[model samples]
Target: MPTDLVTTAGQAAGRVADALAGLDLAGPVRDLAAALPGGRTATLAARPGWAELAALGGRARRHSDALDAAARAYLDAEAAARAAAGPA
Candidate 1:
């Protein structure tokens, strides 16, 4: 897929993950857990999947940049070769 698409998808996934995590986990389980010893210390972090997707998007962008550079180099070389070969 295009790097742009990958980036957009990554951003969307990250937003969704953040929204999911933002939800309150109250009720019995939360109460029970909080009733335990160190439940108050229990904190949730960002999901690994969203992070991985974001990383992938960054990687794709880098790869795309590299690919563009290589293509330009190839075209330049081809143009040079054609010029060296004289009219035709």
Candidate 2:
């Protein structure tokens, strides 16, 4: 069975995922990761050329998926940490 993470980290992971889910490239110009406390690290996994493509008016869904996967990895690592810390 899987373990549950500490409430704080779980909350952080969930917020990251929720923010990814809410991304809107066309709605308004805003930085999502900058808004989170540790979001800079979270965006490190984004695709290498997302902005260049966006600047060229190309689709960025694949890049977004890469970013989402990175967020999920963080969540998974957090869960692993919780497991290592012992049962909740």
Candidate 3:
């Protein structure tokens, strides 16, 4: 794949990861839970939701890192190839 495409994909993934990281779901949930009567209900509502959000963010970050690595590898390969060709 082209370096530009890979780099752009990486950037997009990074943005997604950033957006997910910025989420304040827990605070809202905690506030809402506090308004409610029971601790168990709050725990049930909060844990799985945040876990899934965290997992999604992790996946986006990993994807961004992989794309960045691929872009770097491609650039390195191109540079090496050009160096091997030498003065052409």
Candidate 4:
């Protein structure tokens, strides 16, 4: 079911996020920004404070959180619907 797929995806994302939660993205972001061909965007990504790195990590975290929340909501709604339907 779609809910099952969502659950699996959310769980996978959450697990990955948890594992990489402490990872520092600054250096990698800087390296990538330097290597990228983009103009000012690359410069912004490589900024000294690593603010872009923080933002990137924050966005990923938020995405993972959103997925998990969506999965929970879908599961909850399915359960409620099934209960209302009752028996088969």
Candidate 5:
């Protein structure tokens, strides 16, 4: 439970969360669907695929959030322990 490791984990999780939040999981497929002549058919065909992708993205974001929370909790606990031990 080294503070440096905890901090690094938090930072890594934050980066992952940012990336996941910014992801455009369905944008490419949606664009392709719109560009096709039978746009409606393409859209229908891709509907399930995009939906699944979105769901996976949501799950990944949630996991990232959990990781961040865990890292924060560890840091907080370490701080509390140091404070309780007082004066080195």
Candidate 6:
């Protein structure tokens, strides 16, 4: 039963990651990936669970954050490119 709950949480995390992917931002998403573990840790602190939940959540959040960061980086780079092209 706990595994099932963890699986559901994992799926939810994946969905969030997918949504973040839709955004267009700038740079590598690595920074976000690096910070994701701690972010997820904080979230789970509010509600404890078995190691499976923690592991699943951490992985999911990292993937999600990376996706979001990529989108943000893409958008920022595009904006900067446009601004640089305009007259000074």
Best by lDDT: 3
lDDT of 1 by residue, 4-71 (tens): 45445555655555555444434434455456645453332221232344455456555555555555
Sequence-dependent TM-score of model 5? 0.54
Q: What stretches of model 5 exceed 4 Å from their correct place?
A: 2-50
State TM-scores per candidate: 0.45, 0.33, 0.75, 0.56, 0.54, 0.40
Could you tell me which residue pairs clash in candidate 1?
none
Per-residue C-alpha lDDT of model 4 across residues 10-88, encoded as one tens digit per residue: 6777666666666777887777887885787687886677544445555666777788788789889989999999999
| Cα-based lDDT for every prediction | 0.52, 0.48, 0.83, 0.74, 0.67, 0.54
Clashes per candidate, residues 3 or more apart or on different chains: 0, 0, 0, 0, 0, 9
Question: Model 4 residue 72 lDDT?
Answer: 85
On TM-score, the leading prediction is 3
In model 2, which runs have C-alpha deviations exceeding 4 angstroms?
A: 1-58
lDDT of 2 by residue, 1-88 (tens): 1222333444554555555554555332234434443665446534354344234322333444455566677778877889999976
* Residue 49 lDDT, candidate 6, scale 0-100: 35
What tens-digit string does per-residue lDDT give for candidate 5 at 9-33? 6566566666665566578777777
Clashing pairs in 3: none
